[model samples]
Target: MLIKECKGFELEKEKSNTSEDFFNRSEVTFIENGEEKTLHVLYVRYFDEILQEFTPYSQDPILADQGLDVTFKDIVALVCLLKNPGLRGRKRLYINSKHDFAAYFQDIDFSKLPEVFQSLKQKNSYELRSPLEFILQPK
Candidate 1:
């Protein structure tokens, strides 16, 4: 059976590489089927001169599936979680062709992700660490 959704997500911001222009890099841990699986996430931010605020240019998920247990539904859930719907115009979420979803995203069923996200969000124990705490904590 496919792993349709995770129990929850943990976003721990990773240290930025000075050579890269990324806004935030995170180690996103997905609590799925009583196991903690992780994926690397990178976000590119562009300063909007008119809005006077930083906005996401793109978001990417790096899944090293060598020994990792993940599914296409997890990819859908990840996309639904990371893709900022609040953005007005262009699509900023990017997933490379290596992952399973990259090849069959259009064909895959994504109906269950929304409900999973709602359930995950409503849980009181879920917490995302601040940047400061991320820096202080050992990897």
Candidate 2:
């Protein structure tokens, strides 16, 4: 059962050693129950592969201070919640009105974020991952 398909995405590579420049441009394909879709996502180094990406902005100090670890998966979850307001159920994850979606990260806990971004080197890899990618990816 496929959930989503990322047909295309853009990447902006950097010239520094920072992981921020790793994923310059990339695309993904999502398929679900015979249905297919395309979404734009930023790719970056993950585990042992360089084809993993996620979204929802990790550089935001709010996420860092909240101890919420940001990752590709988390970004997907956020996008899911955004697309489907019903999923919120009783959770206070979404804001009623806000143009800057990243602002929500301020309430999250960076320390509580996924373990995938615990290391410094991996942090660089995190940079490659784009927040917009998660928005397009299915939950």
Alpha-carbon error at 83 in model 1, in Å?
16
What is the alpha-carbon lDDT for the whole of candidate 2? Answer: 0.32
Count steric clashes of candidate 1.
0
lDDT of 1 by residue, 19-123 (tens): 354332333344444655444433332211111111111222222233333322234334433342222122233333334223323322334333434444455
Off by over 4 Å in 1: 1-17, 22-27, 32-35, 43-101, 124-139
State the C-alpha lDDT per candidate.
0.32, 0.32
**lDDT over C-alpha atoms for residue 122 of model 2:** 40
Instruction: State, as a TM-score between 0 and 1, how close model 2 is to the true structure.
Output: 0.24
Would you estimate the TM-scores of all the predictions?
0.30, 0.24
